[model samples]
Target: MGESLFTKVWNMHKVKTLSSGQDQLFIGLHLIHEVTSPQAFAMLKERGVKVLHPERTFATVDHIVPTKNRQRPFQDELAEKMLAALESNTTDYKISFFNLSTAYQGIVHIIGPELGLTQPGMTIACGDSHTATHGAFGAIAFGIGTSQVRDILATQTMAMNKSKVRRINVSGKLQKGVYAKDVILKIIEVLGVKGGIGYAYEYGGEVIENFTMEERMTVCNMSIEGGARFGYINPDQKTFDYLKGRKFAPQGEAFNRAIRFWKSLASDPDTHYDDVVNIDVSDMAPMITWGIHPGHALEVSKSIPALNRFSVDEKATAQKALEHMQLKEGQSLLGQKISVAFIGSCTNGRISDLREAAQFIKGKKVHKDVFAFVVPGSVQVKKQAEEEGLDKIFEAAGFSWRGAGCSICLGMNDDQLVGDQVCASSSNRNYIGRQGSPTGRTLLMSPAMVAAAAVKGELVDLREVI
Candidate 1:
């Protein structure tokens, strides 16, 4: 039997099997950001050690950077300090830092791929949980804690346990208005929040194969939400085409050689997985998360799940979510009132996402009472959107067009929802207090769906508006 791509990549990066039964794996790319790198850098300073491979490590600021007014001496003192520490650390170690002044600066996950630093058959690590976003390039990428970040910074390797591989085959064509975001939400809903524990999800089948690179990234970006350590799709011509001509991509004869190596990393036809799951998305509809957790979701046309439908072990949490959300059981989320609409995040803040929302919302206006905004995933995406006049379309529709950053996605920056306001957001994670206010409610959906909700001041079927 052939080996899975996970196994192949793991073996290639395996430094040694530790006595504790964990493999010491060399990280091909180590991404860092302001929020998490400060502590790790301090640890290195305390230990009197320098970065083992500064060249392999990259730094950027996103989580705490303000999207609106991005002047120095950030209003949040702690955020300012963190950024300063990152700048100092990167400079001291001679590592590449994509500061705010550089156009390459944006979300760490977004910049890595656009610059061609992430590639197939490599091990990538970052301090952010969504580091799995890089897996869309057919690489083994996983998030690590601050201590683990320090370990990699000092030694260029970190210890990790091997995970079982599960093939998630999504076949058939997706229906109109159904998007990559909906497909992932459906996977999380069916597989349950904990279904992917101890496994690496290998996404395949006709639907995934036909998806664009940005779509694949959106799918892999939320792997952690499903409890998967990492997720990946096999590299193919699409992968090479996207990587070619990128800033850091190989050129000339080197490009050909790199392509051959990348293609070789793809899983064989008969590759065996520890488990397999098959899903057909031909009839899938746009999905929305009604409750706090990502798993508490259903089709737009479906009613919210009643407490009685949950298993005994799930009843308590279900009840808690419903009360916190101030929602009634069995109520359909369609036409639910929304006060805010957010269209950005590592999950759906790429140029394609912006363009999709812009095209759908063109010549339309945001609801009079609703507050709407759009944030690009990276500086490059922001520039591209402006060049394509997507920014003007959103602005004309009364949506606030902000600079690139994580923004309201995590409430780490100044952008956050007010008290008890329900928001239609394209970001991942609908957990309570995820958007700043403890009573603030977040309804997760695609950028287009968010656009629809903004236009109607309520959750409406995107298909009807488009």
Candidate 2:
């Protein structure tokens, strides 16, 4: 019997099995951000500890970087403090950091893959929940907490219980307007939010196999929403192509040798999995989350689910999301007014996402009542979008082309929701108060969907707009 990719990576990185039965896994790459590392660094400082492998850790500022006007001594005092702390910590600890002024700087997840730091058969860790995004490269990636971050920094290894592999195969062809974002959303809807507990999801089949690296990242990025600590696609030709010319990737003859190893890291054809779930790609639609949780979603053409339709445990959660959103049950998601439209985040902030949105908004004007913006995931993505004229299309359509950062993805930055505004956002998470307003409503969808909504000034089917 052949080994799965998860097992291959896990066995290679496992240091030893602890008495508690957890494996002390050595992390090949550790990504960090300002929001989660401040306290962890402080803990290390107090304990007189030094990073065991500072070269393995990379840091960047994203969550709290002001998108509009990124001047030093930022308007937000707390954000300024966090930025200063990260700068000081990284400098003092001799860790590599992508500062705001660096062209490489952006969301931790976005920068890691773009630089080819994420590789097959690697154990990757980060403090953000969406760190699973790197799993698209066939690595075992998981989100670690602050304490674990400290442990990784101090010892280069962290203890973790093993996760069973659940192979999710999506076959058939995806219809027009149904994107990678929609595919993952449909999976979450079918499997429910907590379906993959204690499992590492392995995505395969025709649909996943045919997807581009960026598309795979979009799908793997949201595995956390499905209750999976990690999710991945087996490495293939597409993966090798994306990493070939990257800055951190090996060069020339060495690159060919690396590709050979990368190819070998793929799961064998007959690898066994603990469980298998199949999905039909033809049934997926352009999906959006109508409620607080990413799983509380419906197709743009569908109506909001009624409270009575939910289980008793889900009823309370649904009602709370409705109350915070100021929405009624069975309401039509179509034509629901939107105050803001955001097209950036670690989840959907790549150059590909910008191009997709620009294609739909090319000649159309944004609705007068809507405030829409396109914030790229990284400085590199921003430069490429400009080179491709996507930035012009967005700007001509009345969408503000802002600097890169986690703009409006969360409430930490200057970009925020005012009053009880309802935002159509491409960023992950639609949790209440996530967009800087306690009562602000967030409808999570793809970058293209957000652009379409901006033009219509409401929720509209992307198929019609496209």
Candidate 3:
């Protein structure tokens, strides 16, 4: 039997077997952001230890950044302090910091790939849970806690237990209105939230293979939602093409040499996996999450799962989700009114994502009762969208064109929904309180779907609008 990419990357990065039955694995790339790195850096200072491999690490500020007015001395004192700590730590340790003054500044996940720091056959770690976003490059990327971040900063290696590999194949073509975001939501819905507790998801098949690098990133970005520690697609021509001219990627003949190594890291045709799953998207519709968690999603035309339809194990959670969302079982989310619409996040804040939404909302107007906005994942993405006049499309349609950062996605920043607002969000999570307001309800959908919702002020099928 051939080896899976997960095993190959894990074995390559293994430093030594620890006494606790976890392998001490060397992290090839360490990404940091303002929110989580402050505590880790303070611990490093307390322990009198320097970063083990400052050269391999990079820092940026995204969370807690006020997208509307980014002037100095951030209105949120804590936000300003966190950003200052990150700047001081990165500068003192000689690690590269992409600050607001630089065009390269943006969300941590968005910059890593654009700069070519994330590549195939490597181990990447970050303090954010969505660090799995980097696994789109065929690397073993996973989120680390504060303590784990300290471990990587001090030793450049952390103890980890390997996961079983599950090959998931999504066959057939996506409909005109469906998108990568819809695909991932469908996967989580079918497998349930806890279906991937001990597995590394390997996505493949006709649909995934044909996906652009950005599309693959969108899919890999949400692996954690399905309980998978890691999710990835094998490196391919599309992967190499995307990385070729990236800022940190190799240049000239070195690029060819790197590709040779990257090509070797792809899984073999007969690679063995502990388990396999198959889903067909030929009939898949654009999906939206009607309940609290990501798994509570149903097709827009379908009604919410009634309590009677939920298993005994799920009844309590289903009931709680419905209650918090102020939604009734057996009610279709179609024509459900929304108060807000958000387009941006690590999951769908890339340039391609922006373009998709921009194209759909062009020459359209936002609903009179809805408040809508678009936030680029990074400054570079924001620049690219402006160059293509995407920002104008959004602004003309009554969507607020805001600066790059996490924005309303995780809601650590000033951008947040008001009380009891139902938001059509392009961000990953739909958990209650995820959008800052404890009473805010987030309806997870694609950027295009969010655009449609903003235009109509209700949950309408993309097919109908587009």
Candidate 4:
């Protein structure tokens, strides 16, 4: 029997088994951000400690940094303080910081890949929940809390139990108007939000293999939402092609040597898995989150499922999401009125995402009542979009093209929904208050779908809009 990538990586990183039966795993790359690391750094300061390996840790600011009007001394005093604390801590500790002034600064998850910091076979951890985004490169990545961030900072290791690996085989080519975001949303709906507890998802099959690096990131970015500890794809030529010449990736002969090691990390043909799931995406359509959670979703062309359709344990959340969203059980998400449209986030804020949206929305005017904006995932993405004239296309179509940061994704910055407004958003998660306003309703969809909604000012099938 062959070994799974999870087992191979776990065994390679395992320092020892602890009394609690959890393995003390070494962290290869530790990512830090403004929000979570401040307190952790404070704790380390109180203890009179320095980061164990400053070279392994990287820091940036995303959450709480205003994408627009980014002058210092932000209106949100708390956000300003977090930014200052991160700057001070990184400077004093001699850790690399991607401050706002640098072209490298962006969402931690986004910059990691674009900068080549995330690599195959590495154990990556970050303070943000979407750190699994790195696993798209075949790395073992975890989203940790503040204390765990401190642990990795001081010791370069954290205690964790090994997670059972599940092989997810997604086959079939996606139809036009459907995209990677739709594919992952459908998967989450099928698996249920909590279905992945104690498991690591290894994505494979024709659909995933054919997907671009950005698309893989879209799927892996949501693993945590499904209760999975980590989600990853096997590294292949496509993965190697994407990493080539990247800032932090190996170059020349070093690159050739690294590729050999990276290729060896892929699961062997007869690898064992705790469970397996097979999904077909050929006939799927654009998916929309009608309820609060990512799992509470349905095809844009389909009507919302009645409460009776939910499992017994899901009925309460189903009921609450309906009430909060003010949606009827049998109502169709199609033609639902939307007041805002957002196209950005670690999930769907890449250069490809922008190009696709810009191409579709060109020559179309946004609905008068809808306010729409696009924030690139990173400064480099922003520069590329501008060079390609994508920014002009967006602006002419009545969408605001703003600077890079998390923007409206987490509602930490200035951008957010107001009142009970309904929004068509490309960002992940639609939990109540996820976009700042507790009553604001977020309908999660693909970047192109969000562009379609912006044009019509309502939820519409991408096929019809296109």
Candidate 5:
């Protein structure tokens, strides 16, 4: 039987089988950020062990960095100290550091791909959960905890159990107003939050094949949310084209050789999967999350589900979400008042996402009562958006154009929701307390959808606005 891409890559990286029945996999790339690496570094210091492969490790600051008014000695002392620790560690260990002053500084996930550091047929790990974002390039990428970080730093290998592979084939073309974000949200809703546990998702079929790299990244970025440790798309012409000429990509004859290997890394035509799921996106509509978790979602045209529709065990959680969101069962989310709109995160902060929102809101203005903002994923993305005048379009539309950082996606940064305000956001995760305020309500949607909400100050169909 032919092997899936995950099998091929995982086998290639397998160093040895441990007595505990786990594989010691050699990680090709190790990514670190300010929030999680401090304790790992301290652990290494306690052991007096040096990083085995410093050159393969890369560090950046993102989670705790304020997007606005980024002056030295950050207002959050804890955040500032974390940054200082990362700086000192990287300097001492000789790992590449993408500090704020560097053009490469931004979200670790964003910068890794832009610089060609995340390539096909590699095993990648990061201290952040969304490390699966790199799987868009056909790599086996997943998140690691602090102790796992220490293990990788000291030995350059991690103990991991092999996971079953599930083929998620999304067929048919998406409708006009729907997007990759909508596609992923629909998948999560169908599969349930725990459906993908102990499995790696291999996304394929007409819909995913036709998607751009940015769109693919957006989908794979949420694999963790669906309970999958990692997700990947097979590398093809589009993948090779995106990597060509990138700073860390191979050059000259080496490029040709690398392409051959990358192409071979794709799963065979008759590759076998442990399970298969097929979804047709032809009739899919723009999707939004009504409750705290990603699985508690429905199409924009649909109403919040009635309590009786849920399993007995689920009804209580559904009721709690309804109370927190101030939403009624059987009520459509349409026209739900929103006090804020955010369009940025590693999930949807690429140049294409900005352009999509900018083009939609070009002649429109934000609602007077709504506070809206845009943040690029990386410094390079920020520069490209400015060159394309996306920043001006957003600014003129009353959206705050901010610097690159993982802002408002989590409660770690200064950008956050106040009180019980409802927000239409393009970032991932709407769990309670995710946006700073314990009572803040986040409705996750596409950038274009968020733009429409910002303009109307309520949940409205992007199709109607366009």
Candidate 6:
């Protein structure tokens, strides 16, 4: 039997077997952001170590930067300190840094792909959980903790245990209003949150193959929510096309050679897998998380699951989510009042996501009670949106157009939710206290869905709005 792409890439990057019985894998690309790298860089200085491969590493600020007023010496003292540390450390280590002034600056995940630093047949690691977002390019990418961040920076390699591979085949054509976000939510809902433990998810089938690079990024961005350490789709034409003119990608004749190599990185037709899952896109609807956990979601038209409806093992968790969300059993997710609508994050902060939301909300006003905002993924995305008049559409609809950063996504910056105020968020997580306030409720949905909810002041169907 042929080997899966996971095994193929893992073996290709293996440096050595460590005494601890783990594979010492060399990371082809290392992505760093402000929040997690400060401590790691401090540790490196204390130990008198330099970044082994500065060329392979890239740095940017996102997690804690305020999107509204981004002047030097940030208003948040801690954020200012982190930014200073990152700037000094990157300069000392000779690593390329995407500071705020640079047009390339954005969320680490978004910056990596848009710059083409993320490519097929490579290993990618970042200090952010959504680092899996790079897997859209058919690379093996996953999140690393602070300590592991230090490890990669010091030696350019980290030890990891092997994981089983599971093939998630999504077939058929997606209906209108259904999106990549919906498809991923459906996968998590069917497979449960922890179904991917000890496994690497390999997404394939007609629907996946047909997805644009942005859509694939959306699917791979939430692999961690499904308990997968990593996720990827095999490289294809879309992958090559996206990388063709990227700054880091090969140029001239080198480009042709790179495509040949990338094409070979795809998994063989008869590749073996530990497990397989199939989903039909035709039956899918736009999804929203009605509770804390990402898997605790339902279709817009469906009601919240009762405690008894879940497996006995899941009842306690389900009940907790329902209670924290202030939702009752069997109550429909529709008609939930939202106080805020956020349209940017690594998960859905790409230019395409912004345009999609703008397309539906143009000329429509936000609900009187809803406070809405649109944050581009990077300065580049912000500029592009302005060029296409997307910024005007949002601002005209009363959606505050803020600067780039991880604004309102993980809520480390000034952007946050107030007590018990529900938010229609395009960010990754919907966990309790994830949006800053301890009692803030976040409902994860596509940017367009979030806009619809903001307009209707409820979880209205995207089909109705579009």
**TM-scores of all models?**
0.99, 0.98, 0.99, 0.99, 0.99, 0.99
- Residue range 59-89, candidate 1, lDDT tens digits: 9999999999899989889999889998899
Q: Which regions in candidate 1 have their CA more than 4 angstroms from the true location?
A: none
How well is each residue in 190-290 modelled by candidate 6, as lDDT tens digits? 98899999999999999999999999999999999999989999999989989989889889999999888888888888888999998887867789998
Q: What lDDT score belongs to each candidate, Candidate 1 first?
A: 0.93, 0.91, 0.93, 0.93, 0.93, 0.91
TM accuracy, model 4: 0.99
User: On a 0 to 100 scale, what is the lDDT of residue 342 in model 1?
Assistant: 99
Model 5 deviation from native, Cα RMSD in Å: 0.8
What is candidate 4's CA lDDT for residue 330? Answer: 87
For all candidates, the clash counts are 0, 0, 0, 0, 0, 0
Q: TM-score of model 5 relative to the true fold? A: 0.99
- Among all windows of 10 consecutive residues in model 5, the one with the lowest summed lDDT is 311-320
- Candidate 6, number of clashes: 0
- The regions of model 6 sitting more than 4 angstroms off are none
lDDT (tens digit, per residue) of candidate 5 on 1-466: 8888899999999999999999999999999999889899999999899999999999999888898988999998988989999999999999999999999999999999999999999999999989999999999999999999999999999999999999999999788889999999998998988888999999999999999998999999999889998999999999999999999988889999999999999989898898999999888779999998998989999999889999886789899999999889999999999999999999999999999999999979999999999989999999999999999999999999998999999968899899999989998899998999999999999999999999999999887778
lDDT of 1 at 201: 93
Task: Estimate, for each residue in 1-466, the C-alpha lDDT of model 4 and write its tens digit.
Answer: 9999889998999999999999999999999999889889999999998899999999988888887888988888989888999989999999999999999999999999999999999999998889999999999998999999999999999999999999999999888999989988998999989999999999999999999999999999999888897999999999999999999999999999999999999999999899999999888989999999999988898999878988899999999999999998988988899999999999999999998899899999999999999999999999999999999999999999998889888798889899999989999999999999988999999999999999998988998767
